[model samples]
Target: MAITLSERAADHVARFIEKRGKGVGIRLGVKTSGCSGMAYKLEFADEAAPEDIIFECRGVKVLVDPKSLPYMDGTELDFVREGLNEGFKFKNPNVKDECGCGESFNV
Candidate 1:
């Protein structure tokens, strides 16, 4: 079981951390809300919890809590640009469906 970030995603995150001036890495998690029952949650981590699972990719750290591991295992995160919009995209092997608005997913 593993979660990783694409090189572009890692670079993007690293730049954000540098600009913010304080962060150890980025935390990725899931929350129960949204039309499809689950939505992705992201935040800059200043410190890590004892139970957090950390994966190092492309010279950056991607942190995940133990509870989210099963749902996010084998996920590869990417940062993409489409026309004028750009954001982090999740390539999750466990996702069975996503909401029409693309805000949430169900496995």
Candidate 2:
């Protein structure tokens, strides 16, 4: 029923929004693609649609469409670093399996 972001992810998103100079929040969704059939979609949203379900965490906002909510419920978005590589990671409780390349998942 809800999505949250890690502190690090919030900080990273806030910094990016600040640098970009204009953004309402990050939009999270899922689309049909990749081997597992559903791939995560992310983007900086300058405005929210009327149907979006918004979640606030660490002073940052995440917007999700109602249609995508069921697949992503109880997901926590996080930013992480590993040596020279760093990126956003998803800790999704509903994900029963993920593609080998980590690009897609299925509940």
Candidate 3:
């Protein structure tokens, strides 16, 4: 099982890490809150935890907690732009349903 980042997503993350001057990679996880029961969480990771699973994609590291692996396996993180709107998107194979606001999902 693994999680990955699109080239654009990786590029964006790399730029952020460079700008911040220090970081090991980005961490992806989920939290139990939101209309659909789960919401994606993203943050800069300064280091990997012992229980974290790391995947290298597009020359960037993507970190995931062991507990989140089953739900996030085979997921691809992407960065998208549509006119004035732009942000990270999740392409998750395990998602059965998503909330109207696109902030959460249920498998």
Candidate 4:
């Protein structure tokens, strides 16, 4: 099980961490919300928890809690800019269905 960051995403995250001056990496997880039952959560990790499952992608660490691993396995994160708006996108293989608005998913 692994979560990878595209080159653009890795560079984006690395820039943020550099600006913040304290983050060791980024954390990825799932939460029980949104219309489709689950949603993605992200945060800057100052340090890795002992039990976290870590994957290295493009020189950045992508940290995942063991519980969130199943849902996020084989997911690739990408950073994109579409005209005026830009943000992180999740390409998750485990997603069976997603809300029409693209905010949530169910396995």
Candidate 5:
């Protein structure tokens, strides 16, 4: 199992980290909340945890905890701008369905 970031995502993350002044990478995980039973959690990591599984993509590091791997395997994060709204998008192959609001998903 693995997680990845698109070139656009990597560039966005790298720029944010540089501007923020400190970071080792970005953390990707799932939490048991939201209408679809699961929601994606993202944050900057100043340091990696002992159990984090790390992957490098386009010069940026993507970190994931073991428990989240099954649901997020083969997921690629991308940054996009549609008119004025912009954010990270998850292209997760394991997702079976997502909530109507697109804030959560369930396998």
Candidate 6:
């Protein structure tokens, strides 16, 4: 039961945290939206909730709510740059299928 971050992702997140100057870490979760019924949500966490589970990867902290863990366990978050397009990508072993737009998935 854990989430991981690629080195590039950790570097990117660390830089963002440094620029913003006030964040405990990044939070990762799932929300009910998009065509596939679930979409990944990522945000900066100023602090962890009492019920949140934390993972340390690449020297960066990753926070997750207890409820979101089942859906995101063993997920690896990666930062990618492809020409003019770049963003965070999820390599989720639990994902059964994903929407054509690549914005959502179902497990």
- The estimated TM-scores of all candidates read 0.96, 0.98, 0.97, 0.97, 0.97, 0.97
**What is the C-alpha local distance difference test score of candidate 6?**
0.96
Clashing pairs in 2: none
| Top lDDT model | 2
The residue-by-residue lDDT of candidate 4 on 1-107, one tens digit each, is 78999999999999999999998899999999999999999999999999999899999999999999999999999999999999999999999999999999999
Clash pairs (backbone) in predicted model 3 = none
Please give, for residues 1-107, the per-residue lDDT of candidate 1 as tens digits: 88999999999999999999999899999999899999999989998899999998988888999988899999999999999999999999999999999999999
Residues 1-107 of candidate 5 have per-residue lDDT tens digits of: 77889999999999999999999999999999999999999999999999999999889989999999999999999999999999999999999999999999999
Off by over 4 Å in 5: none
Residue-pair clash count for candidate 5? 0
lDDT of 3 by residue, 4-96 (tens): 898899999999999999999999999898999999899999999998888999889899998888889999999999999999999999999
Q: Candidate 5 vs candidate 6: which has greater lDDT?
A: 6
Q: What 10-residue stretch in candidate 5 is worst by lDDT?
A: 1-10
lDDT of each: 0.93, 0.97, 0.93, 0.95, 0.95, 0.96
The 10-residue segment with the lowest total lDDT in model 4: 1-10
- Model 4 Cα displacement at 78 (Å)? 0.3
Candidate 3 Cα misplacement greater than 4 A, ranges? none
TM-score of 3: 0.97
Off by over 4 Å in 6: none
In the range 1-107, model 2's lDDT, one tens digit per residue, is: 89999999999999999999999999999999999989999999999999999999999999999999999999999999999999999999999999999999999
